[model samples]
Target chain A: MAKQILSPLPGTFYRRPAPDQPVYKNEGDSVAVGDVIGLVEVMKSFNEVKSTEAGKIVKFHAENEDAVMAGQPLADLE
Target chain B: MPIKRLLIANRGEIAVRIIRAARELGIHTIQAHSTADVDSLAVKLADEAIAIGPPQAAKSYLNIPAIIDAAKKTQADAVHPGYGFLAENAEFADACAVAGLVFVGPSANAIRMMGDKVAAREAAMRAGVPTVPGSDGRVDDLETARRVIAETGFPIMIKAAAGGGGRGIRIAANPEEFDRLVPQAKAEALAAFGDGGLYLEKVIERARHIEVQILGDGHRAIHCFERECSLQRRRQKVWEEAPSISLPEAVRRKLCASAVALAEAVHYSGAGTLEYLYDDASGDFYFIEMNTRIQVEHPVTEFITGVDLVREMLKIAGGEKLRLKQSDIFMRGHAIEVRINAEDPAQNFMPAPGTVTELRVPGGNGVRFDTLLYQGYTIPPFYDSLLGKLIVWDEDRPAAIARLIRALHELQIGGVKTTRSLHLALAADPAVASAQFHTRWLEGWLESNATKLAAE
Candidate 1:
């Protein structure tokens, strides 16, 4: 079974915590529930997107710094 | 070369305002919009629309490169940044210049000069404008801050050196408070503006926030008179009125002249406002700062002076010099403007962005509703909460207040919480009715009457 982690807000999605930092969860990276996957930048503020289901990250749906709408999938976990 | 076609690098009512002004001037308009604003009123009404970038302002409205690229692609001769976003950005003006497009504002040099509050204060002082007693320049260390506070006395204003729009300000009443507030103010300033530099100024109690509207064409400038913007909520103006009723004739003239002097000193062009903190106790006014863009409350000045400021801005940008001499302009009547924000006042003024299910705008004599909202239009949640501005004009302040009350009663909106009812309550309040309120009055009034206003 696969689960999709959806963005909780509409804004620019950043894979890294900071520009210089590496991606929070990379491709094929193992993830746990309550893990910070990425950040959604909106109105100069960043909201962390966390995985709700424990699984291994299969792939990211949105590219780094890509603008994403609310409920848009951020990554796939299988 | 004149501006034959204009690219509006903004959104909402201001973009619509620019488009209409350009249309009246016989110039075509290209509205630059984000994906979220594709169906906006400005985009639909424009002669052409271009998708600049994504929904986020950083990638769209504030994306200078994309905006200039859009202007070039649309063959726009000029770009009009209608307030906020990139309006006062010196780099945007420079980019427009580099791209061979008129920026429809003051020179990049002027923007740079006024963008920094400390530098602007220096400019005002050079122009012989009275400024609030404070540190001579940016306070470099805690020692300097302490010394300035001591010299200026207690209850001082600790302000960010490179701040505007009411952010990065903290008041300190005593030595302990001053010591506690300086680092916090500096830290907040550093976070907000990337500059921890601070300045100190003596806080004038019960001061009135007044500003004068000035139009310049690089040759000379003239004042359109003054506006009383004292009624503010947390330093943000909620209501503004032109030809401040409380100002004496002498003080008013001096204030307007000082504004003109400041504008002339900068060789400022287009519509700009010079804000002042007027102390009624001493019958003196101190220059606060200059806004290098058309203000949200400009309509009140237009109503009182009968000057279409936007039209004048276009004309000035089109290589025409300002034709209105100082003697030619005259104040006609009283005018008031109330900002209608899409925020629930009772909910800590939280933004209530949503689709407008219905909008019954007020009409009749001297009533104008400047808005971009329409039925079924979904207001994106990524911008300022200002849904519209309700302005009214009449023979006097009392009449204007009466008319404004009637207009507020008639105006209707749905599907989102607004400051409409709050404005109604304020308008009906005796302090507001008598034009007797200061910048901090509204916050105090809300503290006492928020529940009552919400219940009503």
Candidate 2:
């Protein structure tokens, strides 16, 4: 079964920690629980979005710098 | 040419502020907004509204080309970059001129000059203003470093020339610490910014953040007086008061005059603020930097001076020479302003962005609530957390504080956590009441009163 990674915060989502940095996790990258998948910037404060269940990233639902809502699916895991 | 139509390239409370000022001046207002702010108060109040781009500020408010296109499409004769997004951007100022539209602030040259720390310091020195004594450029040699240290004395800061934002710096209280930290600071600077260069500056103790508000029309300039914004969190001022209570009458005259001198030297146009750090014990004030846009705390000065600063900016941009002289401006009484941000004081001021379910705005004589909040309005999560500024004025500082307290109590907003309670606690604080706080005072106060603030 496949699972979706939902953002717990409503804000702009960034795949990379910073503009100059690489994406935290690319498609096909293996993820573990507590691994920081991305960052959500809400009102100028950055909050790390970490995965809860360990799995492999199948695809990213949101692009870099996409405005997201609470519980919005950011990535899919299998 | 007088401005007939104006385009506001900003959002939130400031956009509303610009619209109000333009409306009073009989100028048609075209508010440029993001997709998230379509239903904002500013949009509804504006004579016209246009969408620039997406919700993110970079794609919207900060998008220069998009904003320029909007102005052109709307046939706006002037552009107002209300503080924050492209407010102090020299390129944006130049871009507006290139597009044959007037920018409602200083020239691009003035913004460029004051934007650089080194150039601004030099400008202050040339205008005979006292600046914080520091090493004249990089202290690359041991002899120069020793001489600079001797001049600056004990309790000095060894800062990296290329470093900023409170990084790559170390404070040495004495000679022993200086000796131990110099090499370490050099190594850190080199590792962080690829530069081993360093400088030294005198660490002013008990420094209070004082700034003079000045207006100009490219020739003459006048000051509205100084504002004290020492109460800060993470270098962001949360509360502000005009006519600094700490400055003696003589010191106040000198501080405000120096700012006017600097403004006139540059032939500055529109409203600008020159920031300074004052040490009351020594009765010494030093120029720090200049903000070339109307600041968030501007309302405090407005209350004390009875001047419409935004209106003045519009008039100046419309090719009018300054209508008022230095003698025409006078400080009436004490005024205070507290920022009401969409933040939960209980959660360490964590930003809370949601719909404003219910709203009860405070109203009375000498109390003003400049906000974008309307019933059922949702504050977007993409921008800063500042929802409004609650300003109050009275006969004196104590009276003003009392009014602030009363106003804070009467104010109410629901469905989103606000910083009103924290401001209430600050109003009641003994140090704040007596105006005995400094720039570093609020962070400590927040830590000590965290439980109490949360419980409230």
Best by DockQ: 2
For model 2, how does the per-residue alpha-carbon lDDT over B38-96 read when each residue is reduced to its tens digit? 99999999999999999999899999999999999999999999998899888999999
What lDDT score is found at residue B326 in candidate 1?
95
lDDT of 1: 0.90
Alpha carbon lDDT of each predicted model = 0.90, 0.91
- Tally clashes: model 2: 0
For residues B291-403, write the lDDT of model 1, one tens digit per residue. Answer: 99999999999999899999999999888989899998999889999999877888767666677888999999999999989889988866777889999999999999999
The CA lDDT at B258 in model 1 is 95
Q: What is candidate 1's fraction of native contacts? A: 0.24
TM-score of 2: 0.93
Relative to the unseen true structure, what is the C-alpha lDDT of residue B168 in candidate 1, on a scale of 0 to 100? Answer: 81
